[model samples]
Target: MQIVFLIEQVVNGLVLGGYYLLIALGLSLIFSVGGVVNLAHGAFYALGAYVSVQLGRHVGFGAAAAVSPVLVALIGIAFERFLLRRFYREDPILGLLVTFGLAMVAEQAIRMIWGAAPLPASLPAALRGPVIVGDFLFSRYRLLMLGVVAVVLGGIWLLLNRTSFGRVVRAGIQQPDMVAALGIRLQPYMTACVMLGVGLAALGGALFAPITTVHPAMGAEILTIAFVVVIIGGLGSFWGVVLAALLVGVVRGVSVHFAPAASEASMYVLMFVVLMIRPRGLLGEPIEKFER
Candidate 1:
């Protein structure tokens, strides 16, 4: 029974980790290339969840889930062009302040549009059942989430490591001036990165909507955990973020089972320990310039 319980917790942890990976992937990409710590990321996620719910009601679950990320990605591109582009040459602190303000604005907008109440989101009928694996049963939707995360991560890895576009992105991260000197356009690439990041956040929101309540303030709550994941994994390291998210998820899941009171606090405690031991984070490289 004890072993069975532990296995169940591990499965639950993986499900949570999938959501973290989707969100953190975008956060890491934006940080790595744009050098911006986007506080509004969670806002994008919340927007996606709300959009998914509304669209789901009108068009069915499949269409809603498919459309949400694409719409959110376009909004992200607009934000990059209108807002983030202007701040690129400014001080990093200024960018942070701008995004922080944007986050607040997004939350208020969500409240005004959706009200303060939580909305219900449900999995499609096809994904509503549980799958039996030995003596354990697992939600099909969660298993689907794991598969989707794997595909996204793998696709991102290929894009970054295998393609010329990825080479330019890596070069830009290391030395933006050199890339600019070579006459490679940086704006488009940066915009793409922002869109990709925002899209991932939106995807996470849509995926998690069924399991969690969707509300105006939801983004603020998840933003804290996302930052913790980013810090523990190390800024700008893709795989690092993935590993750290999984670890945090496992810690949180086990804590919820063994000590419900401490479940919420475990992530902060883990962050504290990581900071005390390695200020740079588990997989993070030392930044030439400090990034928050």
Candidate 2:
């Protein structure tokens, strides 16, 4: 029974980690490639959830999930092109402030559009059951979430690893001046990265909509954990984001079994420990964008 419990927690933690992975990877990329501390990233997530819920009411969850991220991406594109591009030459703090204000405005806008009340988001019938593996029963929806993450992350990896644009992004993060000198032009790529990052946050929100309350405040609620994941994973480290998200998820799950209250603080404690022991984080390489 003890071993079974441990296994259960491990599985549950992986499922929980999926939530963070979906959000944090985007943060990592945006901060890495664009040098933008986009506090508004969380608001894009909220928009995704609200949009998905509203759309799901008519179009079904499949169409809702598929379209929500695209909608957020378009909004993100507009933000990056019209607003964020102007701040690239300035201090990163300005970017932070602008995005922070965006977050506040986004929250208010979400309240106006979606109302303060929590909305219900139901899962498709195919994802609404439990999977029995011997004596243990796991959530089918969660297992489905893992599959979804795998596919999405895989696509992201291919985008960053196998494409010419990926090479430009990689170089830009490490040597922006060099890329600019080569006349590669980074603003378009940066814009794309920002849009992609916001889209990923939105995807995470839409995915979690069924499991949690779909409310305006939900984005703020998840923002702290997302930042912790990025820091502990190292800014812009792909594998680091995945590893840290999953590790924190598992630790939180295990802590819930042993000490319920500790589950809440377990992630921070882990972040502190990782920062103290290995500042760059697991699977992270030093990037110039992370420097002051």
Candidate 3:
């Protein structure tokens, strides 16, 4: 029974990890391609949830979820063009400070627009129940969320590995100077990268709104966890983020079951241990820009 219970917790953790991946993977991709640590990434996520909820009230849940990310991606285009574009090759600290400032501004905007109160979100009747698979129970909505994440993951993998756009993006990450010398403009690609990154973050926010309270500070809350996943997975490696997210999720879940007091700190502890052994992170690749 104890073993079964642990297995159940592990399964739940994987679901949680799927959510983590949605947010963290974008952060990693943005940093990998554009060399910007988008502290404001979570703000896009909060916007997604808030927008989805508002749209859901009128358009219904399915349409809202489908459309929210596209809306956020549009916002991302403007953000990259006007704000992030200026700091691309500047001092890294400048980019960091700017994004950090943007995050604060976004939070305040949310507070002003939505008020400081938390918004409650609900799923469609079809998605509100649980399923008993073997002796374990799972949220019907979560399984659906997991499936969506998997599909997104597959699509992204294919995009990066199999497309001409991906080839340029990959080259830009490793050898921007060389790509530039070839007469290829990377600015457009960077814009698309930001769009996709924030769009994924928004999708996470939209899908997760029903399960969690939609609040002003929710973006800030998730940002911390996303950073952890990124750090653990290493920056430029796609699979590293995926692995770290799942590992962090399982560790947190198991810790909650066995040692409630340590649940919150478990990932941090794991991070510390991993860093002690491998400072570059698990499967972290050397980034060209950062090398200098």
Candidate No. with top TM-score: 3
lDDT of 3 by residue, 12-100 (tens): 99999999999999999999988889999999999999999999999999999999999999999999999999988989899999999
Best by lDDT: 3
RMSD (Cα, Å) for all candidates, in order, is: 1.7, 1.3, 0.7
Considering only N, C-alpha and C atoms within 3 Å, which residue pairs clash in candidate 1? Answer: none
Candidate 2 Cα outliers beyond 4 Å, as residue runs: none
lDDT to native, each model: 0.88, 0.88, 0.95
If ranked by TM-score, best first, what sequence of candidates would result? 3, 2, 1
Superposed by TM-score, candidate 1 places the C-alpha of residue 290 at a distance from the truth, in angstroms, of 3.7
lDDT of 3 at 10: 98
Residue-level lDDT tens digits of model 1 in 142-248: 88989989998899999989999899988888778889999999888899989999999998888888889899988987888899999998898888899889988
Error of 3 at 105 (Å): 0.8
What are the models' TM-scores?
Answer: 0.95, 0.96, 0.99
Model 2 pairs in collision? none
